[model samples]
Structure formats: C-alpha cells, structure tokens
Target: MTSTKIIHEKKNSDMKKLLGILLSISLLLAGCSISDKNKDLSQEHLVLSTIWFQKSPEAKALFYQAFNIAKERVVEFNKEEGEKPKAVVVDLDETMIDNSPFQGKMVEEGKPYNPEFWAEWTKLSQAKATPGAKDFTLFCDSIGVEVIYLSNRLTTELEWTMRNLDSLGFAFVTPNNFLLVDETSAKEPRREKVAEQYDIILLLGDNLNDFAEVFQHRGDDWGVSVVEKYKNEFGRRFIIFPNPMYGDWEKSIYNNERGLNENEKFKLRRKAVTAF
Candidate 1:
C-alpha cells in the first residue's frame, strides 16, 4: 500500500478506537444514573462533588489554613483584651466533623433525606473531625478561650453528637458548651446564649448561619448586601469551611418551604442560576 494511504488508515483506526472508548464510558455513566420517578439532575452531581470535596487533600489543607488563620486572629483579639472570657463558636457538621458518609449513603442507597435515616446516622456517633479542628479547638482550650459547639442538630441528638465529638478528641466539648437546635434553627438565640457568657471572638462553620441570623433565610438581595457588608470579616472573625453536601444555602432556593418536592425545588434551582 502507498505510504499516504497507510497513514490515513492508521489515523482512521485510532479515531475509531477513541470513539469506542468514549462510547463505553458514556454507557457506563448512563448505567450509573438513576431512573427514579422523581428525578432531579443535581443529586448525582452533588454526591460526586461531596465525595471529592470530603476526600481531597486540598480540602484538608484548606481547613488547616482556615484554622491557622483563626488561631492568629484569636491571638490578636486576646491581646486587645477585656475581662469578658474569650470564646469561639463552631458548627459541628461539615465544620468540625465530617458527615460525608451520611451523604454518601444517600447517593449509594438511592435514597433522599428522611428524618429517620438522619437520626439513625447521628445516633451512630461515627463522624470524625474535619482536619485541624481538634488541634484548633485544643489550642483554644490551652489559650484559656472556651470552645463552644452551636449546631443545627436537634437537641435530642446531643448524646451521639457529644459521643462523636468526644471520640474525635475535641477539647471543651461539654453539655454546657454544646448548644443544639432549639425552638428555632435561626441559631441566634443559641448564639445569644453563648454571647451572654463570653465575648465571642470567632465563629466557624460551613453554613453562613453558623455565623449569624443575617444568613438564615437570606433572600437574593439581602444575602448579597450582607455578604458585601461583612466582606472583611470572612476569614477573620468568620472562618468558613467548604460544604458541598448541603446547607441553608440550598434551602434558600425553596424559601425554606418544606412542601416543595424534589422536582419543584430542582426547577427553582435551575431558574435561580444566573447565566451570561
């Protein structure tokens, strides 16, 4: 055969092989997809993202950096000095603790969140600390600053929540210091509880609510305005961790209404996205 004809045939063969490989991968992904009657496109994407986010070394490193920054600011705030005891409030899930397993099970088992499943998961008391959390909280303890946990986890879940925190060697994790969700999830009242006892120097969490009430049910305009207003406080007094799994940020789309089905929420989320 002529050299040009031979080269052309080889190129064609390579293209065919590549196409075959791509087709196989496409089919594999298709097989992974669920065909539930209540399909919402974001679930698989969120699950995969959560897995990657929780397992990645980058995530661990980011937590390390955030905690380190928190440490530095604590020192500065301490120097400023007041008789009020210094305290730092931290959120539990996705902040101090990793709850990716619960999220993973939801995707793996082809299930959506149910109170029963969530309660069971918390009761297991199996969550581990986010990287650097133990060290940071312990550092706070050594520095004479109280470490308080203010979480949206119901007050009823305290037993396992404390067990989980204790197992992870979290410092200053006591019944007196761990504030759970009460009459409201706004967390302000709980935050106020802590405020009365100590001068809250820092707040850390994955959700913005972990910081304050302004973030809860934050509509589009209000959310943007407040964030812009407190822009400087982000990494300073408000240290935030990444949470790809879930948060109030997700709830805002549906306006905190529990009545919306997955499909309806999905449609709203689609409309909510701003594309150029």
Candidate 2:
C-alpha cells in the first residue's frame, strides 16, 4: 500500500512540473504576439504622419523668421500716433500650442479624428507650447504686444483652451482676445474683427488660412502655389509654422470624407499620384 501511494505521489508531482513548463511557454508566445502586433500598428500610414513642427530644422528657421517679422510689424504699427497694436494675432493649435500628444493617442487607439474625443481632450487642458513659441510670445509681451489666440476650436472648449495656454506660461491680451470661431468657420471675418481695433500687421499660424483668406479652402499643393504667387508677402506680414501631422492638406487629398475605409483611401491616393 505504501509503495502504491509513493508511485501516485511521484506521478502528481511530475504532472505539476509539466503544467508549469507549458504555462511559461504560453506566456512567452503571447508576449511575442503582442510585440509583433505593436510593430504592425506602428507601420500603419496616417495622413501627415511626420512630426514636422516638433522635429524639423526648417520649422526652427521659420520660427525665427516669424519672431523677426512680428518684431518689425509691431515697431512699424506703433510708429503711427495712437495706432499701436492692441494685440498680436496668433492661432491656437499647432501655432502656439502643440497637440501632437492628442494625435499620438489617437494613433495608439487606432481611432480617427472624432469631435467628441477632441472635445474631451481639450478639457484636459494639458497641451504644451510649440518650440520657440513661448520665447517669441514672451518677447512680444515685453514689447507691449498683447497676445490674441484665434482658434477654430468650439466656444465650449474656450475655457479649457485658455487654461491650457495660461498653464503653459502664455500671457493673454484680454478675455476677449481668445477668439473662438463661429459656426461658419470663415476666418476672414475673424481677421476683420481683429483688424478693427488692433493694428493687425503680422499674422502667425501653421496653416495658410492663418495668413490669408485664399488658403481657407485650398489644399496644401494649391496653397503652396498660391503662396508662391505672393512670395513677397511671406516673411514680411505672414509667418507660417510647419504642421505636417494633420491639416487641410490631408483633408484635401482625401476629399474631406471620413467615411472612406483606410484601404480604399490608400488605393485612391496611390491612383492620384503620377510619376514626373
């Protein structure tokens, strides 16, 4: 009876060891699978995927030019008696603030741009300032130029936007200086509103619409052509930052339709391209 019991006990111990080995192997395989899945996800192409504003050398150069242009414009505008600038006009997202983390989060979640998600993210009010923006803005403030942030963000997001800017050390002109776009999405009207009181000389932004009305609806290539037509105005009155992560350019390429599946859009994009 004792010998039989010993045999049974040895069998159970061997079975337990076998189970442990199998579990470790299964866990290792699962870890490898997750690693491969992450690699594949990272390879997915999104429009304006490059971090142009965050890491480009050209972007840094452009920021310097913008600062100089703003300084010159302020000086020129102030020359006129009682015509001093009430405020300097700047765009919010991609202009003064960096929203790359929001984009990164979307990529990680495998989700596209949704208004609800963006609205919630705005409420977080944790966006950092773009490189060189803080320094440029501080210089502007030192010279008595009030900072006005004009954004396409909804009115409901205004409080959060202001809080984000304030948290990032951005000084505001007045509560009114934070201009939220109306339902129309026409920036020309907003510019006109700013021009009424402020000696609006230099306009700073990442998109062409920030500089002129023509780029409001145009694509990046067309906007580039239009800007070339008025190259003289660039670096003088209009200062543009680099924003390759997302913009009207991508919308133009995709025909502004969010319903198109990723595969269908990629096929269409490939068809549209022609070899020179």
Candidate 3:
C-alpha cells in the first residue's frame, strides 16, 4: 500500500476511535444527569415534608427544651397574685411555618428571591406547619399563654397568612396576636410592640434579631458575636429552629437580591472563599 493511503487510513481509524470515545462519554454523562435529577427530586420531596411536618432529632430536642422552659416560665409568672404571664412571641416563616415549598420552587426554577413571588406564594395559603410548632402553640393557648406571630411577611399577606396557618393546624390567634409588620424592615419595633402587650418571656425564631436588636445594625460578624454573647439563651428564653436551607446565614455570604445574575453571584462567592 502507498504511504499516503496508509496515513489516510490511520487518520480515519483515529477519528473513528475518538468519535466512539466521545459518544461513550456523552452517554455516561447523560445517564449521570438523569440520575442526579431523580435524586434531587426525591431529596427535595423528603426535605419539604421534613421541614413542614417532621422534626429532626436535633430540632425535636431543642423544641422540647424550649417548650419546657416556656411552660415553667408561664407557670412561675402566673403564680403571681394578680399579674398573668403574657405570651410567647414567635416568627412565622421558618420559625413556625414551613416555607420549604417556596424554597423548593426557587431551587427547582433556579430563581432568586423576589418579593412578588413570595407574596404570591404566601397568598396560596399552602405553607404547612413546622413540626412541634402547632402542638406547642396549642399548648400555649390551652394554658392561657397567648401566642403571637411576629413576621417580616408583608402586611398584605396577613389574611392569606392567617389562612395558611389555620389550614396547617396552627390555632388562629385573634387579629391582635398576628402582628405582621407593615413596612419597616427593622424588627426592633415589632419586638417593642410585643413587649408592650406580652411580657415577652420567650422569643422564638431562626435569627438572632428575633430575640434582640443587637445585630440588626451590624452584619454577619456582629450577628455571630451577638449569638455567642447570648449563647445561654439558646434553649431558654430564646428558642431557635434550624433552617440551613435558607436564612440570614446564606444572606451573609451572598447579597440577598435577585438582581444579580448567577455568574456574578458565583464570582462574588468565589472571591469570598479562599484556599490555604
């Protein structure tokens, strides 16, 4: 055979081999993609249910400790001759109400935070009750310990919010008990309002500001410091629920806005991270 013919045959053979390898890799990756999608769907459903209804062991233990403390405080305060124990104030979203569905939609659609989306979701009145939240609130009611929901959720969502809680088995408190913030993003005023009506013995939430205004001005570092300062209140006057899926912690790492594109946010995140 001529050398030219041999070279052409060799090139053709190499090309065929490369094409076969590429096809194999493509199929493998496609399979992996499908598997990953399935896994994500399953995990999302499980997490959604867990957030809405099932309490993890850690959450249950924390709830029990807080419940006992609140119960004791109520009893002690009520023992007073005339003054009655006030109420247990709680944050609604992620504190007592499971917004996992909203979060799941965000994750699935690769969408960022948008007030309109949240407003619409809140109107759906489908958010389920967090585990132990319903029972605890009911217990507070049964014991005459008023339960108040102080939320950052807009006042426009009030009616739907109430309906959501009611549908989720959370006892509907009077309109006064639902203190939805009207406009200000700051929670100090809400806390002050609660203080006026309730003795505010116990404050429950997933964030530090839910308890005090110390970190309201300072950012994440100050928030962390404040949490450390009040570490003793963890299971006592301040009950917290775990919400790793989303919270101020995530916001601390990334700017809490939907305006930034994913790549921009990713670049920012990369800048924040470092390798030793």
Candidate 4:
C-alpha cells in the first residue's frame, strides 16, 4: 500500500476506537445515575405525593373549589322539579374529612396500609373536616336536602367513624344516613339503596371508585378513558377532591394483584411511569 493510504487507514482505525470508548463511558455514567436514584428510594423519607396533599395550597383550593361548585349545583338541583327527595352522597376520607394525618403517620413509619392500624386510627376520632366540606353539607341541610355519608370503612369501624364525623360536626351521622362497607368494597349496591329513596343529585369523593364501580380495577391506563367518557359530569353531578396518598388508581399499576412486596411495588411504580 502507498504510505499516504496506510496513514489514512490508521487514522480511521484510531477514530473508531475513540468513539467506542466514549459510548461505553456514557453508558456507565447512565447506569450509575439510575443506581443512585433507586438507592435513594427509601421509604423513610416522606413521600412526595403525601407532601403535596398535606402542604400544597393548590390541594386545599381544590377541596374548596369542589365543594363550592357542589353547593351551587345543590341549589340548582333543588330548584328542579323532581318527585324524589334530593340528596348528596359523600365519601368520608379525603373527601368530606381530611385523612392526610393518618397517611402521614404511615409515611413516617415507612409502612403501607394495614387494617389494624386503620382501625386504631379511626378509634382516635381525631380527623378534621376537609376544606369547605362542613359548610357545604350544612348548606344542604338548611335547604332540606339529605346528606348521606357513604364510605368504604369496614362495618367493624362504624362506631368510631360515626364518632369522628360527629366530632367534626357533619350533618346526618345517623345509622340511616351513614353507610359503611358491609360485604364488599363495591359501593354500587349502597348507592342503589340510596337511589331507591332519594334522587342522589351529587356524588362527592376523592377517588373515581367513590363515584362508580366502573372506575375500579381497569387496566394500566388507570381508567383515564372512563374519566374522559364522563368528563362532562365532573363539577356538575360528580365532584372529586384531591387525594395523592392512596386510591384504587394505584391498583392498576399492580395489575390488580395483591400481596406484592415493597420491592415489587417499587419496581412496578418505576416501570409504570413514562420517560423521555
């Protein structure tokens, strides 16, 4: 080969080697970054989701906004001519009452939900009312509209749940008005029972499942399509509060599977997110 051609070939070979080294270094750096991120995912820290729920002014505003719109809708619904009595069905936790304290406790302990801990929390009867919730319910009461508290809290927790609501000065805490989960978490039957007696003008809750059974246990989309399907009903007949701590929406991330360990859930949560 000519001397010039030999030198040119050597230069091309050197360039290829340099490029390969740079690419390998880049991959190593990316791997380190990912490892660092996962290492810091310790549950000891307060979850950002719970932090947003507990501290954000916007979160408080959403509750107020929901109830304010609900009050207006109540007035409008009452004016309409209907044979059945007007009623509003409200979920307890994170909807009519603030349960972020309980969620915060769990977050502090680096633990997930346990029925035993939940029952103990309920027995305390210390949860306060959500923003504008008490006032809106009182407004409904003044207008002669029945306010029914429909919650998924187990029947065993009924006494403490009632005590907590009563402590918060909520209206209609009686046995007839407060309905707890008896057999299943599906609230459709309880809703149907309420429908038999009242018009059910508005349903207020923090979770979509609180509105309808259709929103529960859907695929990985987490019922986003269902929410879009019922888009118009929001702020009209169904009011939703902000709750980032926990909900049935999380079930979709796990494919509705139970008994997943912390690491499995952590992996699933990371995988469920979209990344550029």
Candidate 5:
C-alpha cells in the first residue's frame, strides 16, 4: 500500500475505535437507566421501586406536613357553622399506613400481589403508621370528629386491617368506621353512607378515586377534568398523600386497563411522555 493510503486507513481505524467506545458508553448508560426503571416499575424489583419512600427526605417531610395541615383543617372545620355529625374520611394504604415494608417483602420473595399474597400480608397486620398519621387521627378523635377509614381493601381483610390500625395507635377504629370494599371499588356508595350519618368535612387519600368515583376508569387526562371541576376542594377538603409508587395515574396513560402486559404498559407509558 502507498504511505498516504496506509495513514488514511490508520486514521479511519482510529476513528472507528473511538466511535465504538462512544457507542458502548451510550449503551451502558442506557442500560443503567433501564435497570433503574425496572427496579422502580417492575413487580420483581418492587422493594427498589419504593426507593423514593426510603430515600426522599422530602416525602417524609411532606407526610408530616400533610397530616399536620389535615389536623389544622379538622380544627377549622369543627369550628364551622355545621351541626351535622362531623367525620374525616381517610384511605388506609399509603395514606394512614406505610406498607413499603410489605412491598419490600413481596419483592424479596419474588411474589406479586394476588388475593392470597394480599391476605398473607394483611394477616401479618404489622404495617407501620405513616408519619403524623397517628397524631392526625388522634387529633380528629379528640375533637369529636369521627375518623372513618374508607379503604379499597376488600372486606376479607377487615379484621387484619382493624388489628393493624389498632396496633399502630390509630384511634376510632372499629367495624363501623372501617368501610371495606363491597360490591364496587368506586367507594361512592360507602362514602354516601358515611355522609348520611356524618358530614364528611375532609377526605384524605393517596389516589384520586378515594375522593370521588369520577376518577375511576379515567382517560389520558387522568381525571384532570374532574379535578379542575372541583379544584377548590383539593388541599382544603380533599387532602392527598403522595403515592407515585403506584396508582391510577400510571394506568391512565395506558387506558386504565390492568390486563395489559408489562411490555405493553411500558410502550404506552413511553408514548405518554412529553419531550422537546
């Protein structure tokens, strides 16, 4: 080969090597991102999914602040010009109780949530209280505001839930107060029942459905329309707990169909994102 041709070939070879290294680094970083996402979004790595709960000091502070604010609202509402039976409705999971440990155990055991899986976890009845949850309930009880647990947890888990709540120092917990899932997960009927007796001054929940049934089976807007409709109620009468770990919001992008396989969900979620 000519000397010039030889140098040109060597330069090309060097450039190719550099490009290969850059491509490798890109793939490596992409792989790391995928791994972290799997840990966060997949059932197999459910414990790692809740890293936000364990790692984020802001989340802990938010819980404390949310409950404190709820207490303040309760006090204010009690002093309002209403003589009806006053009550504060609350969701159990991820709101009053921190079930991150249960999620961790399920992940560790390579188990996904099923009827049996949930029954076993609730039967253990050892979920810790969310930050300030106990105090918030206590404050409500002290002020004579009946604390009602309006959970989506099935009726079968009622006993376990009661035991768990009592163990966690939650006050005003009883069969009458803990309204479990009946014919529907909408919770509107149960909430209406509670309303029949007590004026629901506040509804505390992690998911939007806990507040109203309109959020159920919502579209890509993710109940944004309904929220806008009742925009004033939020942070006033509807105190929400942060629960990005899992909720209907994630399902909203994928049409809220739970039957979609993991890969299908992934595709839908990716498509739902906004990028420049």
Candidate 6:
C-alpha cells in the first residue's frame, strides 16, 4: 500500500478504538445510573426500628434493666476501687436520651437523614430522657461520682443538648461535664481526658465504640468479635443501651463506606441479611 494510504488507515483505526472506549464508558455510566434509580431509597427500612424504639415496652424494659445493672456496678466499683475519685462516662444520644422521634419523622416522610432537619431537631431541644437514665445519673451525682457526657454531636449543638438534658431533669448538666465532638468523632481522646482526672468506673453507650478504640474501623464481624472478647465487662464496666434505629453497626453492614446514597445502602443492607 502507498505510505499515505497506510498512515490514513492507521489514523482511522486509532480513532475507531478511541470511539469504542468512549462508548463503553458511556454505557457503563448509564447502566450505573439506571441501577441506582431502580433501587429502593425510601426510609421504609427505618419503620420497624423506629417503632420498636418509640413504642415497645420491651425496649423500655431493656433500658431500665441496663441502668439498674449500672447502679449495682457503681456500688461495686465504689466498694472495690474507693480510694480514687471516680467518674461514669456516657454517650448522650441513645444512652441517656431518646431520639426516636427524629427517626420516626424520617420514616413518616419516606426520606433519609437530612442534616438540616437534624440540626433543627437539635435546636428544638425536645428529646426526652431514656428510661432510667435520669435516675441513674442523679444517683451517681448523689454519691459523689462525676457523670461525664461524651457525645459525637458537634460542639455547635452543645447549648441545645444541655437544654434538652436540663428539661429532662438530668443532674450535672454543665459545660465542663458535657464534651461534644470537637476534632474527631472518636471518643478515646475525650475518654482519656476524663481518665486523667478520675478513674472511669463505667462507660455507657449504645455503640461499642463509645467504650474503646478497639470497636472503631473494623469489619462487619468486628463488632461481634470485639464484644465477645470483652463479654465479661458488659454489665460491670460497660452499660450498653439499645439503639436499633442507627449506629456504627449499620455502617459496618455497608462496609464502612462514607457518603453512600440511600440506594447503595439499601442494597448492602439487603445483601447482608441471611436467607434460606
């Protein structure tokens, strides 16, 4: 073939190859868009969890049981480790107060969590105390043990959080006792700060990460595995409340992915469930 013709043919071939690659990429993106569109994104999955949290007698019983056990553990700690000043660390959201109303609103509207709505919810300062939480904290205060609320809520929400606690008649609702998220969501640093001043006799939270660093950044099975490893400390050193609505456990189900759309989250959640 003539050299000019050969060069022209090669240029045509390269152009065709580039076009094929572009077509493949376009098709792949189109397929992904359609798949996401078809997947369920409504907050329907939150219904049962919200219902159980807001309406179930069993849920209330569990909270009361956990705090009752916590009281006993506190007495034990004072008897055994009475030499040092002590404190009890607690997570505010599900540990000391109920936010199921927020969850229920989401379910009712068939929408996922909206930061704006959540901010408004916090501003309202309407969350009620979980069963037995007030009594337990007050009991600790009466006995001279410090009650520190270490929560992941942003520092900006501190005022409303305090108002909510105060409205619920919580004892020791002071700025020094309430530590909200500042630099990071991890509680270890904040817990360490409390440890420096007082021996933390007990830790109360719905999520395992509230107690230790071991529970953070693990696989789906890591939560269960770590819990098993510390099984003996459940009632004594850890008082876990029920929080079926949302937690790190759900994040693990999605492989700890951040900013996953509701559709992607629903798919992972369904895949994580066992079926016959």
Candidate 5, residue 153: CA error in Å?
Answer: 0.9
| Winner by lDDT | 6
Q: Each model's RMSD to truth, in Å?
A: 11.7, 6.3, 7.0, 11.7, 9.4, 9.4
Model 3 / residue 24 / CA error / Å:
28
The global Cα lDDT (0 to 1) of model 2 is: 0.75
TM-score to native of every candidate shown? 0.81, 0.76, 0.72, 0.82, 0.80, 0.83
What's the best-to-worst order under TM-score? 6, 4, 1, 5, 2, 3
Tell me which of candidates 2 and 6 scores higher on lDDT: 6
Alpha-carbon lDDT, every model: 0.84, 0.75, 0.73, 0.86, 0.84, 0.88
- Candidate 3's C-alpha runs over 4 A off are 1-73, 76-85, 219-222, 255-259, 270-276
lDDT for model 3, on a 0 to 1 scale? Answer: 0.73
Model 2 TM-score is 0.76
Task: State which candidate, 1 or 3, has the greater lDDT.
Answer: 1
Which pairs clash in model 4?
none
Per-residue lDDT tens digits for candidate 3, residues 1-276, read: 999999999999999999999999999999999876754553342345445434467766665666666667666655555354477788988778777777777657545558998887888988877667888788777877788898888888888988877777777556777877687877889888777656776788887777787756546463677777878877777777666666665566565555565556666667667689
- lDDT of the structure predicted as candidate 5: 0.84
Model 5 steric clash pairs: none
Ranking by lDDT: 6, 4, 5, 1, 2, 3
Off by over 4 Å in 4: 1-46
lDDT of 6 by residue, 41-147 (tens): 37878888889988999999999999999999888887665555999999999889998889878776666777788998899999999999999989998888889
lDDT of 2 by residue, 180-240 (tens): 8667676888888888888775788888787778766565464667877889877677777
Error of 5 at 231 (Å): 2.1
**In candidate 2, what residue range of length 10 has the lowest lDDT sum?**
42-51
> What is the Cα root-mean-square deviation between model 1 and the actual structure?
11.7
